[model samples]
Target: MRLRKVMLVFKKDWLEIKRNHEVILPMIIIPLILSIGFPLVFIVGITMVPESASSMEDLENMIRNLPEHERNALSQMTPLQASIYLFTLYFLAPLFLIIPVMVSSVIAADSFAGEKERKTIEALLATPISDSELLLGKVMVSFVPSFMITVISFIAYSILVNILSFTMLGRFLFPNLLWIMLIFCLSPAMAFASICLTVIISAKVKGFREAQQISGMLLLPIIALMLGQIAGIIMLGPVIIGVLTLSIILIDYAVLSLSVRAFKREEILQKLI
Candidate 1:
């Protein structure tokens, strides 16, 4: 339970993460695409398309279902302007969640499972760290980088969105309360949950790739959220984001607690044998 021992494990894993191209590539590429590529395409496409295009119908319908205040705000803009504003700020919001979950899952998948793959599990378990110290260290390894990546992605996305939309909207269009809550609150919770789940799966599985594949399923809920907002079935306003944040935090606590109880150095060593 000592912080010094926990950090020793954290430092060791951080070093491994830096050298693993499989882990580093996605961590870098995915955020770039989500922050830069996606927004650029959406903003340019929306700006070019005429208001009378049939594709505007779906966006219009989605906006109509928004709350009165939000609907009123969008109503002030031309269809093109509204489309760019809404899509960038809201419709694509859930995609940001993917960065954290994916980053954490990839690293957590490598935690113990990668040790087994590389034949290093015995050496790691032989260290003097207690089970709780080891578990917390692994959790921090995943959570720290994932959360940092999520924040940086959010900043990049926010800047790009403001720059892209500035000509049409005549104002900066990001860093609003909803997004603030999303990155600072819900994002960490989701990332922690993904890390814990992936850690558990990583320990139980036989290899890093297997653990990663299973952890990838964690994206289903985030994907569903994106679709729900687009379909007008749900909206990620302040209240909703707050609720989801609390729910995910509770889930994270429960999963982490379970991981601590169930994780055993000898059990993992036995699996390696």
Candidate 2:
């Protein structure tokens, strides 16, 4: 592989990305709402609600309906706090997974489709880089930003969660095993999966919005996880998160293989109608 040549390709693309705020800013703005805004609202609002109110009374009834084994799980917290804390936290957890996946999809969709929209796709295809190398470069551009944003977002979220825990709960309540797996494992795999899939879609797609709309389907699993937790059908925990990470990794491997195998320059140039 020609490091200098690949670096040149990456550099030119980076400069192009820097100038294209129309394509870039939406990616960051969406993540802001998903990661920062929602967490702040949920944390502060929950702490402000009266613990002994009718809301808690209703929550207690629902808790009683849970299996004794599941109910035993929350023996760590007072009923009032559990109603506000664990109950809501369970529903909020999947947002972490979903946000990163969506961000990756946006970036990947833009990397290829944006080039096409700018009328630069044919020129980029004319570079000295082989098809595999060019594809690898595109993958790097998408994968790096997605994974980096996830890390930064996690840091921002941790600080916010700790602050809310101290100011509202009078202690730290975030950063448990479930979060550890969600942050370090499942989340990155999801990003990779989204990036790979979107790169292919974006290469074939002429419109960024179309690629983005189709790529948004990557959020389905996270959405389902959120709903399941809200309905009390499942709980977010280290064990469940571990299983989820493993399942995603397996799926990622299969999807990534398809991505690499399906990436054909001739086919891409001909366009997939």
Candidate 3:
């Protein structure tokens, strides 16, 4: 209920997070790779490969394997062009989702577990703040940084891709409606879901590494979605993305509600006994 107390907790966490290189490095490095490095490589590689090197038969055979809808979607583009769009744009969307999820998970995994590891949980719990305030503060600490990183990464990615491919595509081709929706609508929910699950696991686990390792399991579904997209089985249209966003929102709500219910200072205190 008290904003001041929440802000104090948030500020404390922020300071600690900045001092932790293990957390800070991955947060920076992964986004750079996902948003900048990979796209640069894919776009540059596609443009460098001679179109003459690939046969029409080869292109057609590859396109034939795609579903009818997918085939129609890329019907106008050459194989190399299609590969460029697919790799730099469509395929990277789900993979980029991993950035926020990982960022949130790493931080949330440190929420209570790190406190326990440092023998600081007792002091934190002894502070004059309600459990809800404590939880909210921790949630914000994880969610805000992760969300900002996701947004910044997406913007950087959009600029990198559009500028890099402008000559080839003839216009700004990055940030399609689906991607915009994915970033604005689905990403927060996904981050919240990861953080909530990680916090819950952190409270139950004994060490930061264990909590982080357990929370890493949240990426399995994301990896599966990435694979499905690669296989052309999952097309991320507005309708599909809307459904995905809704599903993630629901899951986030469920996990957060359960986490709050399960979060008892007594329980955590007993674990330390």
Candidate 4:
């Protein structure tokens, strides 16, 4: 519907989100840990170990199992440099996917369930906004913040990664094609899918916590991606990222269409009674 009405609902929900510690804490903490803490720990640990440690067998195996082009790229680096590169780029990549889905689900879980919990659903529904306007507004609110957080975390991770590995690699090792496609393309699609699904869950559920718990199951796929890479079942190259991005976008379209059809303000109000 109208952009003005959509923005009004967006502003109102965003303001409430700011004061909500339950929502704000995860949004801030999770990104920090994924972007900075994990990288710092892994890189520092890699630096401390002597280059000759045979414990690197697992790492070597993982690298050896990578796709031909990837293997060729790492073939140039010394063992230490290659180890750092593998961990930072390939291993840690899926973890970044978690950030957007997690962030969006948390906020979208609060979209309507939080209203029901706080006994504010009636007031929200009483507003003059149409169903489409309301739905789009909530979707935007969740999508915008989650996407921004993912981008900012990517930037921070990129800088930290480049800086920490600079001594060993003698170059900036961040912002490669795979990562760029992963962040800019796949991340938003994933976030939108998570938000729309969570919004639907939020409408049906009784409380914010219940909605959040259900939405948390969305992490399963991302975890599978991470494990797949470790087991050498799959690798996230530029082509794979592009494919996943398009797939998720299509999923988002279907879920969003379903969400619009299912989200009836009158139905939600009836439940509140």
Question: Which prediction has the highest lDDT against the true structure?
Answer: 4
- Please report the candidate that would top TM-score against the real structure: 1
What lDDT tens digits, residue by residue, belong to model 3 across residues 1-273? 899988888999999999999889988998888888887876666678756334445445445545577678677767676776666666788866789999888889999999999999998898878887888788889999999999999999888878856866667776688788888888788889889888889888899999999888999988998877766567666778799899989998888888889888878878878
Better by TM-score, candidate 3 or 1: 1
Mind sharing the TM-score for model 3?
0.90
lDDT of each: 0.86, 0.71, 0.82, 0.88
What residue runs in model 2 are displaced by over 4 Å at the alpha carbon? 1-9, 48-80
- Could you tell me the lDDT of residue 49 within candidate 3? 73
Which 10-residue window of candidate 2 scores lowest in summed lDDT?
Answer: 52-61
Rank list by TM-score: 1, 4, 3, 2
RMSD of each: 1.6, 3.4, 2.8, 1.8
- TM agreement with the true structure for every prediction: 0.95, 0.84, 0.90, 0.94
Best-to-worst lDDT order: 4, 1, 3, 2
Question: Model 4 TM-score?
Answer: 0.94
**What is the C-alpha lDDT profile of model 1 across 101-181, one tens digit per residue?**
987888899998998999988878898899899888998999999889889989988888888678777888787999999
Better of 1 and 2 by lDDT: 1
lDDT of 2 by residue, 1-273 (tens): 666665666677667676778646866876788778876675566557655323534555446545575467556656546654554355566777876777777667887788777777777777667766776677767776767777777777777767765764687756766677888888888787777888888878877888899998878877887777766567777777788789878888887788877877667656733
